[model samples]
Each structure stands twice: as C-alpha cells, then as structure tokens.
Target: MGAPQHEDVDTVDVDLYDPGDGSIPVFRWRQAGQALATRRQLREMGLRPGGQSPVARIECRGGRRFAWLYRIDLAKPKLPMTLAKELALDKAMAARQTCPKCGRRYHHVLPLKTLGSCLECHDGTPADPASYVTSAPAHRLAA
Candidate 1:
C-alpha cells in the first residue's frame, strides 16, 4: 500500500506518511528513526541542531507530550563551556541567592520576589550557618 497523504491531524505514523508539502512528519515515541533525534537526545549525544529546522515531531501519552526531531546527520557538536560563560552564570546565580538585607549568600535561592530577602533577614527566623556562606563574595562583577 502507498504512504498516507498529509493531513492536519496531530499524530501520524512516520512510516505510512509522506510529507510532500514541506510539512513535518509525526511519529510515536520510539518510532522516530535513528536518523532523527529530539533536542535533549541530541544534547546527550553532544550535538546541537545547528540552526536546522525540525524535520519531524514525536508524540507520547496520546499527543499530550511532544518533542521536535532534528536530523542527526546535520547536527553540530555542542559548544564547550568557556570560563567567561561560567563566571557570568555564577554572577547571575549570585543575584538570586544573595540576601540584600543581611549580605548573606544562601546555598539555595532566596525568596527575593515575595520577601525580598532570605528567611532569617525576612522575619528573624535564625537561618542555619551551614545553609549560607559566612559572607558575600568579596569581589563583585563589573556593571
């Protein structure tokens, strides 16, 4: 039998569908061929889509969850983390984890939005010493 024609439905069998109108094919979980991989899968393989558009989609749980599939052959190697990127990310995280009132940087993120400070600074809850750095980092990122 011939492949099924493209339709507007959500789920379609990859093997039985032919995308002649530039529409992306859809496949059930585990049915997408080895040549195709989702973003997370590509990341696990140390690859990125490299600006290529998705060639297909995979759906599971009756189409409630889906991921875009990219051509593995066209994927590029994942970029390595640089020292500057690491420092920048740490600086961003510092803003969230630091307490403005007490100058204490907690190991976990503080309730900055609602309380505007860490638990101890917010209501004198006596935060554990182990939970936060003794003091904020000495150096600050340049504005």
Candidate 2:
C-alpha cells in the first residue's frame, strides 16, 4: 500500500535508491557547476546518458521503480542516424505487419495467436452452436 519505511531508506542514496514522498521527496542542489537531469530531460537537450550509471534517483508514486538521475555534465550528445540503421529499422517494422501463417502483409498487425492466421483463413464456427439454438419446451394443458 505504501513505500517500505526501513531505517536505511531515510537517507537518499544517489547510487542506490531515491527517497520517496513518504519522508524526504527532493534532494538539495549544490554548487553552480553541478547539474542533474532525468532521461527525458537529457533527450530534450539532444544528449544521452551514454552508458553511465545514474548519479542519483527520484522515487516514483507507486514505488515500482525509481527514476534515475544522470549528471548533465557527463552526458554525451546523441548520435546521428546512419543509412544502414535507417533501413534496418524499416525492415523490422515491416516484419511486424506480416503474418507468418498466411504469408501476407496487413495494413494492421494480424491477430496471429487467437485466429492462428488471417480472419479469412480462420474457421468461424462457434464452439457450441447447438446449445445456443435450443427450442423452448412445449406448454402442457391443465385439466
């Protein structure tokens, strides 16, 4: 129902866990040269964490996971997309639209598991059609 209140969780650990709303919610920003940013924050500035571990974290509401904080000073600029990488991404997206059983490409991704193929190839019979079509019992006349 709530974040676990352990003695160790009281102090925020930049390298381990974030102090949630349960007690301390935010960390102090110190010095003019220091900078901290989340993943999306780095992306907005056209930079990435570049395989560096987070220097800090901010706790989320549900306590599922902490939002990692990266030092903006150490972040690297995002790489430009290459022609080969562009082509590979296009091919992978196309594969998702193609149905393996029917060997056909669909504008929408096919429901492969349930229908096992395209809707046209699927047999549409009900699992128990007879049960659905039973007639009502005839009423008997009383004396």
Could you say which candidate leads in TM-score?
A: 1
- Prediction RMSDs, each to the true structure: 9.4, 18.5
Worst 10 residues of 2 by lDDT: 131-140
Segments of candidate 2 deviating more than 4 angstroms:
1-34, 60-65, 82-143
Q: What are the per-residue Cα lDDT tens digits for candidate 1 across 109-143?
A: 99899999999878899999999987546753333
| Candidate 1 Cα outliers beyond 4 Å, as residue runs | 1-22, 83-143
Q: Local distance difference test, per candidate? A: 0.83, 0.58
Error of 1 at 24 (Å): 1.0
lDDT of 2: 0.58
